[model samples]
Target: MPKITDQVSDSGIYLLEIVVPDDFYTEIKKYEGRKFPKGFYYYAGSAQKNMRKRLERHLKKNKNIYWHIDYLTSRFNIGKIFYFNNCGKEFECDLVADLIEKFGLIPAAPGFGNSDCNRCDSHLLYSEAPLDYSHFISRYQSIARFIPSSNDTF
Candidate 1:
């Protein structure tokens, strides 16, 4: 298990681990119908204000689906949340790009979670295996933080 730090930031970047159990197709608002296979997914996002509240909303079972991530998290369970304190929004794109370049992780959906981002193909990445957070932390030692779902609280 990874340790949770006591330090908290009002705004920062976060990665959500989502698990889908079977193959299924569903339409997401304006995007094309998406096909989700049984596997794990990682979504990177940023909240520039009230970061803890944003994360808490994601963990809630009942809420209005507002963002692309909301659509997914509303359907599937989020197993973990890895975050970085005081990280700017740009770091969200950087993390996604790094995952693509270094880990060869591809987007599960082309425009998922990046309607506003011009630099990233998508903020959501799919994988057969869980991401190695230790490796990411080793590379970004100064900012990386980990919080498993069991320990996450507002």
Candidate 2:
């Protein structure tokens, strides 16, 4: 199994979080004291079986454009894409949303709700607050970035 590096992105560079089983929290040890850039990032993903294919579609200059992240790709070319595994269908959606909120970066679109976690209403998703990656450290250790895996290339 490949690692899904945890990621962070700005309009210019995208950070990543590696994908690992939800039960495991080993790699996070490596990110201690490392800094992640702060800015608006569209968080979108699916349970599609092919990671490479999904990344290709996401990297495409023209795509179906369904999720908010897809549309944002137009505004800002996706600088980097992070991949995660064990993020099974059941947990992927909620887990992604949870990570976003737990990190404290304003959910790409907060109009959907203050919290991006699946528990909130999924209507009119929009960000009310500005992107503040620094704020995320308040919620969790800045080191957790090492635990997840994401791609920096394409």
Q: Give the Cα lDDT of each candidate.
A: 0.81, 0.37
Can you write out model 1's per-residue Cα lDDT over 1-154, one digit (the tens) per residue?
2233456478899888887787766657555565678788899999998888888788776899788888778788888878888889999999999998998788888888998899988899998887776787798888777777664464
Q: Poorest 10 consecutive residues of model 2 by lDDT?
A: 17-26
What is candidate 2's lDDT per residue for 1-154, written digit by digit as tens?
1233224221111122212112211122333343323343435444345544555455565777555444444334443333344344444455445555654433333332123445533322223243333454343343323222133322
TM-score for each predicted model, relative to the true structure: 0.87, 0.43
Query: Which regions of candidate 1 deviate over 4 angstroms?
Result: 1-6, 151-154
TM-score attained by model 2: 0.43
Q: Please list the residue runs of candidate 2 whose C-alpha ends up more than 4 Å from where it truly belongs after superposition.
A: 1-38, 64-67, 110-154
Cα RMSD to native, each candidate? 3.5, 14.5
40 in model 1: Cα distance from truth in Å? Answer: 1.2
Candidate maximizing lDDT:
1
